[model samples]
Target chain A: MIKIKLLFAIFALATAFASSAAADMAIIVNPNNAVTKVSSDEVKRLYMGKTKSLDDGTRLIPIDYVDGSAIKQEFYDKVVGKPLDRIKVYWSRLTFSGHGRPPETLSDSARIKAWVAGNSDAIGYIDTTLLDGSVRAVLIVK
Target chain B: MSRWRLPLLLSTALVGGGATAAELKWDGFFTSTYSITNTKSTYRDIVHDDGSFDDSRFGLHVVSDIHPLWRLEAQLFAAGYEDNYATRLDWGFASFHLSERLNLKFGKLKYPNNLVSEYYDVGLAYPWIRPPHEYYSLEEPSASITYESFSGASAIINRRSGDWDLVAQPFFGEVELAESDANISKFIGIKLSASNDLTELQASVAQGRINAEGHELDDQTKRIASLGMHTEWGSLVNYLEYAVTTFSDSEEARTKAGYITLGYHFGHTMPHITYAGFDQESGWGQQSVTVGVKQMLNPSTALKLEMQRITPQLNPEAGAEMASGLFMDVPEKTRVNAFSIAIDVVF
Candidate 1:
């Protein structure tokens, strides 16, 4: 019975870990865009609104998932290098300074995929399981 | 040909609004602080017994993205907690983005000297209920020395080079001092700022000709300069600021000031200590030590509680007759201890 209980605990922990696997995250861009891969620093800069355009002088529109999901946390932690709340503060200061805006929010991954697919300048991230030819994953950090 | 740029941009903005889409975005912040000082005499800018909310303020910031390259920004700030609070146009400016790294702006803008210098009024952005008085004080009434802002033209350059991000701004402007009924002109300044992921630093120098008529002060040449730095290590944050100002036409000239803050964050709570002081060549010096705790109520709001011990030093033997900055316009010279609780919100 003890062995069975230990196995149950291991399963629960594995399930929790699997829910937020960074490997599942893929930074996706519109397939029509020429950019192939994005560096981690570039990703950080774009999301943080430091660089308004890509290195090649192309304008960028970054999108975010609205829900407080593990995927959102993983993106901020691994890519932006800050927690979700701190990012909110950062965006608040920037918005108050009239310097930048937070990324437009979509309700879920399907909407993100649809939105990025339509706009050539748009960038969004999603679960690798949702990857399709409709969107090109430019950088996979996880 | 260059003179037509202003009218051309204005017409473009108006026509562009009718033709293509233009975006108007706004953000706001509110801060309420209740403070009481122990001194019996009433200080000009101090809140004594009753919760005057002298430093409490509400701000609304707006940005109009008329074009990809042209944008207009403004901020309306209101102070005090009374229902009849007065509002002021703290910033109303237009920015023309020359490129991804360069931009030009005109109108009234924050005179950026340090990290908190530009946004000291925005409480939601900083941990303190109020910034250290030594460095970013209101410069008026022969008191507050940090001139918050000026009106004129400025060039902004932002570049990211490897690990260091560089920001350089050259500005020339004039400031109107209402407290003393004065106006400063021919103000030219250059500020250089750099930051990495963990730390940021700034240095600035400026000189302006001042014209004033109030309380035995007038026609002064003002020179101001400052250096500041901020660093963060995990949950620990540190801030240091040093500034100096001199008046060639006044007796109480040459004021030197600095402040240091050390804080540690534990989850939503931050406990910190701060020491700030200023010494005027006129023989009056003042210093204060503050201990505070900041608690984030949510992503958009925070609560801060702090206490401070203020000490004023006036030396008659130094052959100076007056005090500047906070030491001015006080009924009597005395020490004071003060406490404040503030709530800040960003929306």
Candidate 2:
């Protein structure tokens, strides 16, 4: 009986950690956004400023939480095909020439959620647990 | 002293008030490079001799969104491209987006002359610390050098369909040439560019004439076409470009040039091979081949090594009193083999 009880506790703890790790990342878009889904590749292009519009020609404006955020790094590795250093150099080259600007940066997930919720054209990443009726969750990054 | 005082005062105020004041966001970059070659040329003295950071640079940039549709930006760059100390204005522009497909820009613009012209201006932006100096030769090549930077208005248009993307741009501007008031008359040019997941192609044509001291030298015309392909299998990037130019004067002169490069990446290191040739109306032509290697130590840093064999060709003159003038008093042929090492960094 004790062995079974201990096994149950261990399983519960592992499940909790897994859930928290997945919930730590949430792909967010404005409430009015009609897009229901996004592929990992598309998300990468959008955040990198490579593609300016969605499939339906809806203009996209991307935002970021901060430079070194875990979600940001995850998004880059999954989509951007480059590490932080390469992204920095890429942005440095583009921004210095006035060709493009890096995405707007917020302090934390709360601010990211708030910005995406208020702007109809904005998209960002946030903690899934913090999402509510104010915004729409489009995708979940594993 | 006065310029330094302002920063000092601002820091004092921030410390005394203990106010975060919106948490100033910062972004910037810095780079250093070194080059070496055995080409017996005067321009060699101006570039890196070996593995040393002679042509170094550092820059800072910042931008703030004043509104949803508007933003303000500025950048300052300091480099040793020509000498030990020289600061220049890289870009200061105001852009007003008219629509999703169209936008208007007014300010100092980096003119699109060649494939790598804009990024090559900054050392750290490319795998090579110094662009092929023989091709992007700074001073002696009057036409290619002056077209690197300009001031004027530009329009950019882009459209995408499936896995294919298309972009087109046409601009009109006059470039600053030398200290003289010699301004290139209005130039109208257009570029057609297309890209898929693995391959990309671009072609451009521009025409204009130069007016120096009210002396019309000739009507200047330029056309360049290039194709680039990158495949996923080996992470290979290969490109080739051809440029033809014609100048009108009391006598008409034409020049033609082309370059091809194939690069493959192996984890962090990429090795490439290059072949290029160019010809001038002055009976001067050159052909060379190079083998090079580049490594990305990190995202913001890279190192490169290259060795090349260059041969300058001299054509024979008509009605000359020499035998096979092509192999005349030019010691039959002048061959130069050069090796170079470079480092690039961004912060």
> Which candidate's TM-score is highest?
1
- Give the candidate number with the greatest DockQ: 1
Candidate 1: tens digits of C-alpha lDDT, residues B107-127: 777776566766777776777
Chain A TM-score for candidate 1 is 0.82
Residue B24, model 1, lDDT: 61
lDDT of each: 0.75, 0.61
The most accurate candidate by lDDT is 1
lDDT of 2 by residue, B223-274 (tens): 3333333233336767666766556442223556667777876767778888
TM-score, one value per model? 0.88, 0.75
DockQ of each: 0.53, 0.35
What range of 10 consecutive residues in model 1 chain A has the weakest lDDT sum?
A: A92-101
Interface RMSD of 2: 3.1
Cand. 1: chain B TM-score: 0.87
